[model samples]
Target chain A: MATGEVKVLGSWSSPYVMRARIALHIKSVNYKFIEEKLSEGKSELLLKSNPVYKKIPVLIHGDKPVNESLIIIQYIDDTWPSAPSILPSDPYERAVARFWAAYLDEKWFPSVTSVGIADEEEAKKAGISQMEEGLALMEEAFGKCSKGKGFFGGDEIGFLDIAFGSFLGWLRVTEKINGIGLIDEAKTPALVSWAERFCSHAAVKDVMPDFDKLTEFGKMLFPKIRALAGTR
Target chain B: MATGEVKVLGSWSSPYVMRARIALHIKSVNYKFIEEKLSEGKSELLLKSNPVYKKIPVLIHGDKPVNESLIIIQYIDDTWPSAPSILPSDPYERAVARFWAAYLDEKWFPSVTSVGIADEEEAKKAGISQMEEGLALMEEAFGKCSKGKGFFGGDEIGFLDIAFGSFLGWLRVTEKINGIGLIDEAKTPALVSWAERFCSHAAVKDVMPDFDKLTEFGKMLFPKIRALAGTR
Candidate 1:
């Protein structure tokens, strides 16, 4: 029997949703996944629950919805502290992990979104440059943490690893959609290895959607997003 | 005597810096302040200490420098748990506080920055609209906690108050620089009261920079920022 029912209101194709799912699965927490059709506005439950964001990856535990993917992960960790700790215990390490997580949120997402909408050669160049800059920062940050450590917080998959895990999945699909190879095996070998290791983790592997499906969806959505941007 | 020597590397005009200063002050932590000139690039110590972000509001305890404003606030609260807790103990309430804090970082700042560059007439309209939306969201969040209490956390100033307090000061200055007012006493009575109450708090009042100087600096920098944006 489970302590309480955990429900996740999420869109099928959002990387943020994947983040929460991975954390819950890793912690061995039983959760019911609710796929929300975000294009059709949102459910009343979601709107009422997360009036501020009103977006998915809303984790409803004991009928309370916790919005924001990172916050949701932290909530899960705090609730199930005895289970696998997603964040490191040491304050410094935890801060570093959070910094990377935030970097991914702030820098990486925008760069990738740019890639998704790049039309002209110059636009593609600009987008690629931004993406490379973001990647370089991540590489340097991870290099600092790569000293005899299998994971970001060492010896185990922690917050940074989980945060980047979702990004790597999205990056792969993005590369396919954009027809750009930013993360080749030769380039960013450590990050490449880290991605491999992350996907192999049982918890992460279980929650991951089919890559082929994601690529198909990305291809279908790219034109729509570009059209929307053009209209704007 | 204190267990450790605290040092804060920050710029006087930065909202981010004010957050760290206010957090330390509220906790009654003894700390030295170093104001960095951000235009000349970061100092060697600042770069070395927070190589990742390479930005100010780096909280140095003994030797370790913790970068990022919100992260530093969390560290201060964790280090000095005996004092007024910056975040509520309840996981749900804490999550809500973190969500709003993150929302301010994610949505509010960008919207305000966008407003800053809009054409003079458009700037006022956009600035007022953006600030209104931000204030409305904040008003609801604060109102929820305002029941039977003076502060966001009910009794004493907490994380949400500190996070939002820094914004209030900047918003006021930015409103003056941009010549738009969204936080009038009649429009947002609760938020207006909160800002007045926050500014009057001894800890907040102690660390706040001279508002007139900040307004003058913002006026000076406005055209430069616009010129750079135009070129880009």
Candidate 2:
């Protein structure tokens, strides 16, 4: 049940790219990582593969190209429907997973990403406040979704895990840049432990970038992130 | 096999709400449509159901609430799974459907909505330009997706059909408000025909709000839509 010529067109430091790579890793699917040199400009392959958005993390399977990180993850799960299922089998659980994943991408990640790069001190504080509020909600969600297990996907690192887990590197980078503790022991006890288990897990151990490296990466991208933040 | 109560928490004029309702109709599921008076502020039930977004078109199946229009549509398809699938069975096609649906929601819809309500002439022209650009891309997509068939689903209504079809009402409203045609016969002849076919289809015919009613509704919400446009 092996796939033929699976490739991921992405840059090294993107959390979105990590989601696709992590999903591939979890499914035990071997894929070639074709890094896009986005600083120079998007690779011709990336532009051709994803013409509409012209964005990174395009999953090239055979000749078909899948765009968007979440869609790519779902595609991998659907294409390789075997052991180590990414999304839950139950209809309701799958819906819940999709709901939370959307929240992480659409709401939570932006708040966290804004904290370190925002221009005004007031904006940074507001970003931190929003990040904390989002964390509290995620904390409650973890309790409900995990059902007393160690991970959001229960024992295994499933959809929600890869989703929120992908941001762990960026989260760490944010914390290092701001000198703050986001996943606090007092506020989110379960997530504090869950983050440790997720990063060290066999599938994710080497996949997540080093904290210091990501912090340096974050510093370099500060002007660019700030410029782009307003556009979003 | 109908087991329990189904209720839709929605405002009648909303395109997103139409998506949930149309998906239900396609499945022949009888459900109560509870009109939320959103102008008076959100109801307690709506807030409780979707605490994060605090937004509408929540599909309450028995007591469980599914938030977000796209998620609700997917949830409905997953829960029913019997006849007339909303999303395609094939994974690749499903991914493509999700991709276009995301594009419509995140990119195209915003462009079209802005054209009529933008405060300045420059902004309005920009909106029209973006709208045409999006329509051109969608026209190309419709050709590839429909594949010489009457609909995107090829003889049946499906995920992309529901996604784009929901917006036809709003597109018409935008046209009426701006006194300009967004879906041009010369530029987007496929979409022009598809819109007619979609509006006349049984599942969509009764579900889409009347054009005049929606036009009046848009006028009433001009100030509100303009205010929210900047935030997004």
lDDT of each: 0.81, 0.88
Q: Candidate 1 lDDT, tens digit per residue, B146-225? A: 56588887878888998888877668777787667778777777888788888899988877768898778767776788
For model 2, the superposed segments whose C-alpha errors exceed 4 Å read: A1-3, A227-232, B1-3, B227-232
For every prediction, compared with the true complex, DockQ reads 0.42, 0.54
- Model 2 C-alpha lDDT per residue in residues B32-89, reported as the tens digit of each score: 9989996688999999988888888998887888888998898889888898998988
> All candidates' TM-scores?
0.91, 0.96
Cα-based lDDT at residue B214, candidate 2: 85
Number of backbone collisions per candidate, in order?
1, 0
For candidate 1, list the clashing residue pairs, or say none.
Answer: B86-B159
